[model samples]
Target: MLSKRVFSLLCVAGIAVNGIGLFSGVMMIDGALYALIAKNMVLSGNYEFLTLHGFDWLDKPHFPFWCTALSYRIFGIHDFAYKLPAFIFWLIGALYTYLLARRLHGRNVARIAVLVYLSALHLLLCNSAVNAEPYLTGMIVAAIYHFYRTYREGTFSQLLFGALWAALAVMTKGIFVLIIVGSGFIVLWLVRKEWRQFLNYRWYAAVALVLVFILPELYCLYRQFDARPAVEVFGQTHVSGIRFFFWDSQFGRFFNSGPITGHGDPFFYLHTLLWAFLPWSPLLLFAVYFSFGKRRVAMGHPLLWGSFLITFLLFSASQFQLPHYLNALFPLVSIWTAQLLGNMGRLPANGTMHRIQWYSGMVIVILLCALIVLFHGSGWWVFGIITVGVGLAVLVLTRRVSPSNTFLVSYAIGLLIGIFYGGYLYPGLLTYQGGDRMARFINAHIAEEHYPDRLYVLDLEIENFMLGFRCEVPLQAIRSEKQWDAINDGSLLAIRPEALGEIPDRFEVEPVASFGAYRISRLTSKFFYYRTRDAQLGEFRLVRLKKR
Candidate 1:
């Protein structure tokens, strides 16, 4: 086991990396989109409705926006403020992971569980992106922990809090949280044959409390969509927000009948976990195998296995799935992985596990080093050298403290990769995100009194969000010819180069500036190679439109 001082230092290091992400620019696509929605809420002073580019938006639930808007109110609107609430919720996940592990196993496992959660590769990446998953992740684990407590102690307060957290989870995502949370307890009771526990009156009361707590979400959905049936969403009138929340958003996605859909791959998550749980995936595989294969029926905490397996299989079978969807299960996975690592001393295959971790850590470090070299060439030699020196120093120090503790080495390596990604790679990639760059350019020009009227975006969803969150003024969407015709003289317009042909011939469009653009989230080899990067980039033009 790690000493308290060492564990504290590692925890601080993990937190510092997450903080780096907090202050970084909001990412394109999801992050910026979510930021804009929350900013709209603050600006419009209408928390009941979610709007995007002056249209009624009805994709995600309102809980995350509510948290983000509250953060904006407290901290003022900016990237840091937008991401702060999600980061705090992720920390809540870490705390609950520790508490849940401690409850199930002990303090040592709890500490290890916290470390596993903080250093999980995708968790670190998602923290910077600031999506609904972060909020859902924290809430799901918290609800599960409290519900477990209620099961053990039968306290009304615990059950109430569990219901409250579950409600928040539902509000953050959808009704799927109930299945993820409830399945665990049901499995637990069935496995333990504690049939009487299912008959507990508090379970029914918890259901009522969850319903009562979620009324705010229901009311908001009702007023926004149900009451305003004339408003079009998903290109149709009479779209019900409440129905979407309970059915279309969750089950529709599962069955591929929602507005948003994806092709199902049975093994998508199975392959995704190999990287998503990086520097720890090998250990996790071993842990799961040992936990189930050797001690299946004897496993004390069936909640972890039940929740993870049921949710994993459900996501695997779902048509609409994304890698981040698995984040909610990480806390439970962490606890299980931590249990194996915490008992490393007593494990018969301790040497094999140690070697597996060491090799996996080396593989990650090598890949990250290769990426740095590939992206920056020899310019990053100094960085590479310094990283190597730090790695060697960590290995030496850990060896001296506990030669068998490969987890410390792996943890250190994960932190190093996180630092490099969060501090260097992510910010560099943002430069190619034309929307943010254009927004900044527009903000600068506005300060200089160039094209002083309010700017408009050409109805590009992702670009509009990227520019909307950063641009100082509200952006009107030019969705139709009428809206384009309504642009005031000397007002600037942000448009994609390919869409430039759509401008009326009567207007003289003079380009103010052009920005190189790429979807930083969807990277390709052509984009990564400096020699070919320009070819891969599209362009966004800031132009002044004048009537001919």
Candidate 2:
């Protein structure tokens, strides 16, 4: 085991390296969308309801936006400031994960759990994206930890705090927080045959507290959508925000019966897990195998398996799913995966688990090296050199260390890779984000021209929020030709280049600047060849229009 000083040093280094992501550029769609909403909330002084380009956006609850808006109020509106709250919450999640693991296993295993969580590849990636998952993950784990304490010690304070955290989790991502928190406790109760725990009135009081805490979200929904007759959402009339939040948003998505639907592939999450939790995926797989195959169900926390399985099955069966949706359960996985690694002394160096760990470490390093070569081979020589050097050092150190210390070395390597990705590769990729570039262009030109304080702006087909957020201005979306005609000559307009062809003859247009834009996650050789090599994917234009 590592000494306290060494563990503290490692943790500080890991966090400092991981924290490099705060300065990385805002991500596409979701990241930019949330930032924009928060920005508007601060700028417009309307904090109760959510909006997307001046339209009622009832897709998500207001808690996250409220936090972000509050952050902007204090930190003065930068990408780093916008993400600061979520990052802090992520740290809280690590702390809560440690507490929960300490209760389930022992101190050594709990430390391992914390290390595994801090170094998980995707968790750090999510840090840069600054989406709802960070908030949800933190609160859900906190709720679980406190609720577990309540069950173990039968304390009303623990129950109340757990319920409060659960309500915050729900505020972050709707009623799904209940499923994420409840499923594990249900399983734990079942395994322990604690039927009387459910019979306790304190539990019902906790539920009531949850409902009471979620009143703000409910009020916002009512004020925004349900207070009136009907509201338009996703081009549909008479949509109810409360109904969507209470039912359709969670269950409808799970059942694929909601308005927002997608094709469900049963094996989607099976493959996604391989990379999402790298350097630890194989260990987690082995833990599952040995736990079930070896009939070691008595080993580790039963809640881990129950929560992981329930979440895995729910998302896998859902028609609409994303890789990051599993983030909230990763803390549980870390504790469970750490159970085996914490007890590594029982197994020999030649054991199958050790071999898998060795192979997994090698695979993670090699894959990172290959990705760096393929995507950022030339420009990031410093990062490349450091990554290769650290990877080799980790491999060498793994051989020299005891089996227990070997996992630490592997996760350290993962943390280093995360640093390289977040600090170097992500910023490099952001250069290709056309909307951000266009927004910068607009900023400079708008400043140079010294346009009026309140310039009428129209957004067309550039449905991204990055432009408004980066330009530091409120923009109205032009929904029809009438709105297009309403734009004044001194006003500015942004449009997708494809929409330029549809411009009416009544207006004379001058394109001031154009920036190429595409989704980084969708990058492919064909896309690179056409979009980068041939410059054909799409462009965003800042155009000046005058009636002809």
Candidate 3:
């Protein structure tokens, strides 16, 4: 049997392995979108509102872009530079998760919570993707932890830190941050029936601090939209940025009254949780069920129950929802799951723990086999071997490890899978994201003395910011034949095959290159099946329109 120190060291090693692909894969659309915005922020010296495609952008707040812009300044524009800040925030979140879990449930449960938070499949996926979620997740958790510390210890410093963290979260995503961070205090007060907690002068002070910290965000918004100067937005003019930030962005979407709408079936999150929390989903579900087996069990941690349920129900009610929106609540999930696992270990050796371990082991093994089969032909033979080795290690450890440590073993398996995918498989898959490839070709051509005076994007449907950033040229949207008249001898045009309805006899152009292309995020089962069988989705062509 391994010593406790040996087991602990293995767990740490597993986490490091999971982090191996922290910045390997090429940036996807959302990631590239932020990267381009930050690149522009540094280049154009505009640090206020986010901008995309040379337009006023309002889909998200400025903190994430600001951080990325700062990272760009420090590291000089690269994929790692764009992602470094968010990854640091993600680490901060994990640290706070550990500290908060320890404060509530002691050291053992805290360790489990940290492992749960880090090894979460979606969290690992987002770490590489470099989205707002990483920043929000970190800040939200930090805020919650500090707030909870204030509630328990009545530390004024904790309250101040909590308010500051909360402000950062709000700055990152907007008003929705309140719903997530405040829900814990509201739920705790209600559960304990502590009316004084609400009336506490510190609560008011915390709010004031939050407002002060968010002044920069407000100032930026005011300069961008509230100047009373009309700006076109969402196909309309004179749109109010502050109104969108406060009302339309958060509540309007929640109540289905926003300009941006989606098919919110009320149960979208229920199904999404299954895949988003993979390898650990079964355990999480069991923890939920286990908690409900006793009366007033949830009342113990009003913070967790309040944050999880409020965020869950709010998203369920929203007209527009994405799975990552649920990320803010995952820290609570990790804490709850950790406590549940820790409690299970204290009880007499039972069928329940063994059953969970057995089933989880089987799931991991099956997933490994599936991944091996899926990528077998990709010539990632090294990853396949590593997968097999990890699978074998998991199988052996399931029987050899103590029941108390089974959860850690399961987490290691998930992390192993994450390492393989994030480090090896995903990067290999990104080669099919053809816009970046085509952009490189164009960029190389432009580097050779022939600088294109103008660039045209003829495919309205394919809006790849990565392509624009890579081309290092201003992209002009070609809307009509009248726009075609502006093309000159030094003009470059990129068009999707389907977008070109007919070839004009009068137009003289020469093809530079053509690529089989599709969005990496849009890769589906059919795409993989066809790809393994050597098929193409569509063609993207780059041409030079001759000067007439």
Candidate 4:
């Protein structure tokens, strides 16, 4: 067993090192509000950005803004400031996972859970950029654990604590709190019959405490809708607070009636969870094994049935789907996975363990091999270089020992794959995939002295996000035929070079920049960045153009 001090130090060290590579790109959302909230803090000392931006961007609740604004005050609104909330929130999540795991099984299992979470690399990667998802996950998990105490141990203060976090969760991301807290508790009540009898006195106070904790959201609703002389939300001139709770925010998105529209992938959540809770993928596989191994024993735990039902139904029913949407259930997932790890220790680690370890190690070999093979002629060699990189990294890691050599090996291999993915594969095989060429042209020609805030995007690709993050500039996705026309009046434009064929005789091609093999001129990819001459065409960003 690891000592408390050692465990504490290891957890902190693991998370810190995991997050170090990604620290730039604070200007990602392609909107000014990311920077504006911090700017407002410095200028007006107000964290609010509704008036700052043309519209009230109250889509997310306010606590994060206050936290982020304060971070900006101290850290000066850099990538670290934007990421500080997530980092701190993730720290809470790690600690919470430790506590939850210790409760479920014991300390050994808790260590595994912490290691899995810290290595769930995507969490730290994206969490480095302040998003509602990771923070939302931390909020809901803290709430759920506190609420769990009420049902399991029946402590009144614990019930109140649960209510507090639940209220914060509701305000943070809307009705998902109900799914995390309400649905989970319902399952508990049904499974553990004693919970029904205990619900009498405790449930009432739980409700009051929840309301008290959620007062901020309540006040916002009252001030923004109910008491307002005129209120606007969900396309209704004046919104109803009651309607907003059940159907408007919760059921509305599922049915596509509340104005949230995005391409719904039936398998979106599946893949998202795969990467989000990963590095632990092998551990998760082990979890399935352990879950089935002791299925009859742990089957009745309210945590299991409730988390599964809530997370499954929430995503399965929603019209809008995003990977991070299911983050609140992560702690439950980790806790459950931890339970399997702890209980199954009595059994010897056999083929199942080796297969899990081998498959994980194999992912590293495959990715590195792909990198080496693909790096053939691109002014670089991927194999020898990557092999050396991984070997050296492994040498450094093996020097420090921890429990589960299988996990440590997996961690080292995953690190090599993930970083090589960002540093090599991206610049190699996938460089042609995005508008990186166009971004470089604008960067060099436009001059660092001239950073244009008035940006335009003609070609839409995930690569645009890459360039936007790299350049620390916001991009405006040109939506209409008219918005395309507005750019031809002599403003410098960034368009895919291959699009030159589509030019309508009014514009001329001026070469700007190149990323890898793709040139940022009038041509890149014909379908997205078609070679076009018609200056007033669709989807492009304008910097400062020269008259032809």
Candidate 5:
């Protein structure tokens, strides 16, 4: 275990690194799309309905958007404002992680759990990306923590708070959140054979409170879809947002019967955990092995293990799965891993585990260094120098303070990776994201008087969505001749290089600006290498149109 001073300093460093992401641009696809929706909500002043490209958008539930829109209202719409709420929620998660671990284990274990949760690779990335997962991560853990308190003390306030957090989790994602949140309690009760607890009035009251608290989300869905049956969504009219919320949004995805579907592999998260858990992965494996191996031991409380295993199994079985889906589980995983790490004194071959962690930290440092070299951009040399200096400082500090503290070494490495990502890698990559660049150019260079009545996007892509969020003016999609004919002279059209040929020759076009566009989220080796990056990019142009 690290001394109090050392632990405090490390925790501060971890949080400060995460704070760097608050200033980074909203990521493409999910992050930008969510920001755009929230921006539209603020503009339209209709918080009930979600709209994208002027159409009813009905994939996710409304809590995250409401939170973000409120942030926008208070902070004003910008990158930092958009990311601030989610970042705060992530901090909430860190707090709950500490509290829950301390309750189940002890102060030392709790401290380590918080560090592990902070440094987990995907959680770090998700914090910067600013998505639904960050919200869920905090809310779910809070729900579990409060519910545990309710179980122990049988207090009304604890039950109410638990339900409130659980309700928020449901609204953030869908009803499936209950499965992740409830399964642990069920398992814990069953294992303890506490059948009387099952019939406890507090448990029943919690269910009712959760339902009551979620009425806002239900009402929004009702107003948006159920009340207006004529609204077309997913290519069909008379869609029920209420039903989607209760069924299709979560279970439908699990069974691959939802409007949005994907083929899934059971082994997806299995391999994903290997990297997503980073330097902690080996220790987590050891944790699990020691907990459940031939000689079984308690893995913290049954609450943590059951919650993690049940959710992991369900996600693996579900047809719709993404890497971020696993993020909400990290808090529990962190606690379990931390408990094991703290108990290294009793565990045999602890030195071997520490050495493994040390080697893993070294590997991560090498990878981060290599990433800086490969994706060399402006200020790359400066970032490299600072990273090297920090690495050396941490090395000397850890050796002098606690020579065997591999966990600290891992945490420091994780912070370095996060700094490189938030400060250098992601921002540099955003330059290739054409929509934001084009929006910036128009905002800076294009005069308000010269601004087009409507800016049309040639295709609906992630970058274009980012443009929609960042652009001062509204963007309309142009997919057909009729839409093109609707465009007035002097209106601007943002077109991809390949689609430029599709424009009618009769519409005389003058280029205003061109930007190299790439899907920054979907990075490739070619894009990472400067020599081949141009080949990987497609050009997006802002052009003025006039009828001939």
Candidate 6:
């Protein structure tokens, strides 16, 4: 029999192998944004970007500031360097989750939990993309693990650790963690009836932990107000970094109906998770089905309760939504799912219906692999087709011979999807995306020739980050009925067709280039259109619109 150490090493290898594939699917946008922000901060020497991008200041809290900015200082402002820290946090988060599960379940179950979290479709994707989610989640899981230990065993440092981790999570996002963490604590209290424990000395450590978490915000406030004192954010005339950190950034997003829009679809987030945690989505359903049949795990497993309730309710209740916000909840989903799947072994492992489902999934995966080969559009069509066909054949063989190869089948197909999407669909997609290519077009044709006075966004979001990255210029938001007026002082300007239509003054600029299909994407929904003199505009998809 292998020693415990050797078994541990094998589990690590398996998790890493699966994680690498998941991270590969982590598309560029979020990671790219974090990288860009860190680069700008280091290059411009402006650490207050928490307020930058036109003073929705304090709209986002500062853990990201600490994480990315620290990476910039150490790694010197490169995309890969910025993404490295997030990757590390992703690993750490999975590790902490394993420990937590180990404490409650067992070593075997914990190892399975880590593998599940690392292999989970959405969670793995988020790990690849640099966002505050993983960092915050890492800390949150660590805290949850310790907090439970502290409560059950009455340990001193464990309670403090829980508080500290919860605080860090707050710094990463906002007080929404209070919702997640609080929900878990309340459920624990109700279940255990630990009324006296609530008022015990353990409570003070929790308070101290929270205070320590927000220490960075405290320093930033004192530094900004005490030193510069002139800069302001979020219509407050003066920037109170602490207030923004605590409320405006965290809770503000919920209340924000500002010029920035918040989507109101109630079912938006739930549906989004189905995609984010792809391939795993169906398995999560199976796990949930199994959980209902076996009702032993309770809310004291805050990892399960907090993640589920807060994510489900917060996004559903929120006025604004994005798919990534649900990312934190996925680790919990994977943990519970792993627990559920592990338990399934005691019962009947398989039957005709189960085998049929597996066969159906294999068919779907094979078809997708075929489509990927077809769509890649390379002259090596014969080679690509043969390669993927062989791959599908291998998968089919594994499915038949190794019926326990559920994750292998899911992973093989998922990788094919992301590869085809990124390598093929992405480049051709710029015509509709108004993102990477728009700025490239400008840099190639516009920026060098005209010597525009300054860049402006012209009441539009397209070409914003692209121009910033490509031309290294921050596009000022056009603030008035005179949109693009800032750049219109007889100097050259770049304007989207609609923003150009808003100008009342005489502006005669010939069409230097018709960037045909500059921002058309297949995902474009809720189409918009506008007409302008220099550019012909028609209905366009909203998916191509700019976002932070």
The sequence of per-residue lDDT tens digits that candidate 4 reaches over residues 1-548 is: 35678667766657655455345333234212444444444545544332222223335556666676787788875556766776677778878777777776678777866766666656644454346666776777777778777767988888877787777677667765666667766776676665554547787787777767776666655565566536444445666564565466666677777655555666777777777776666666566665566654233246654766667676866788866566666666776655554444344453466456656565556656654554442534644576666755654554433334555565556555545543443334333433444555556655654655645555443345445433434455553566656665444445555554544455555544344333222232232222331232333333344446
- Cα lDDT of model 6 by residue, 139-203, tens digit: 76777777778878987778877887788788777777766655666666765686886677776
Cα lDDT tens digits, model 2, 1-548, are 65678778878887887788898878876888899889888887999878867767777898999999999999988898888999989999999988999888878888888888998888988988778998888899999999888877989889999999999998889898798898887888898898987788877888899999999999888888888646777677777878998899888888888887888899999998988887788878777776776535325577888888888898898899898898998899999888878776664432666667666677777776666665653365676777788888777767644656468666776787787788777786677677788777766766678754432344434335787678755677766688766667756667776677666788888767777777766667754332243354567777777787
- What would the TM-scores of all predictions be? 0.96, 0.94, 0.92, 0.72, 0.95, 0.77
- Can you tell me which runs of candidate 1 are displaced by over 4 Å? 295-300, 377-379, 396-404, 450-452
**Taking the tens digit of each residue's C-alpha lDDT, what string does model 1 give over 1-548?**
87789889989989998778987899889899999999999999999999988889998889999999999999999999999999989999999999998999989888988998999989989987778888989999999999999999989889999999999999999988898999889888998899998888999999999999999999999999999999988879999999999999999999999887889999999999999998788888878777766753224368998988889999999998799999999999888888877776666677777777776666666777777777774347766776777767766665532323677877888788787788768877888888899888777767576556467886755777888999887888876788877777777888898888888887889888998889998989878877788899998888888888
Q: lDDT per model, in order?
A: 0.86, 0.79, 0.75, 0.57, 0.86, 0.57
Checking candidate 6 for backbone clashes, the offending pairs are 122-276, 122-277, 432-519, 432-520
Evaluated against the true structure, the overall lDDT of model 6 is 0.57
lDDT over C-alpha atoms for residue 177 of model 3: 85
When 3 and 5 are scored with lDDT, the better candidate is 5
Per-residue C-alpha lDDT of model 5 across residues 1-548, encoded as one tens digit per residue: 86789778988989988888898888888999999999999999999999986778999999999999999999999999999889888999999999999999889889999999989888888878888999999999999999999999888899999999999999999999998899999999999999998888888899899999999999999999999999988879999999999999899999998898989999999999998888688888988888776324336578988998899999999999899999999999999988887777677767777777776766666677777888888788898888878777766655532323767777888888888888898888877788888899888865855797567886565677888999988878765698878888888988887777888878998888889888878889999987788998888898889999
Query: How many angstroms is residue 454 displaced in model 3 relative to the true structure, after the best TM-score fit?
Result: 4.9
Cα error, residue 71 of model 5, in Å, equals 1.2
Please give the distance, in angstroms, between residue 204's alpha carbon in candidate 3 and its true position after superposition. 2.5
Residue 389 in candidate 5 has what lDDT? 80
Error of 4 at 206 (Å): 2.4
User: Which pairs clash inside model 5?
Assistant: none
Worst 10 residues of 3 by lDDT: 291-300
* Residue pairs in candidate 1 whose N, alpha carbon or C atoms collide under 3 angstroms: none
RMSD of each: 2.0, 2.3, 2.8, 6.9, 2.1, 6.3
Clashes of each: 0, 0, 0, 32, 0, 4
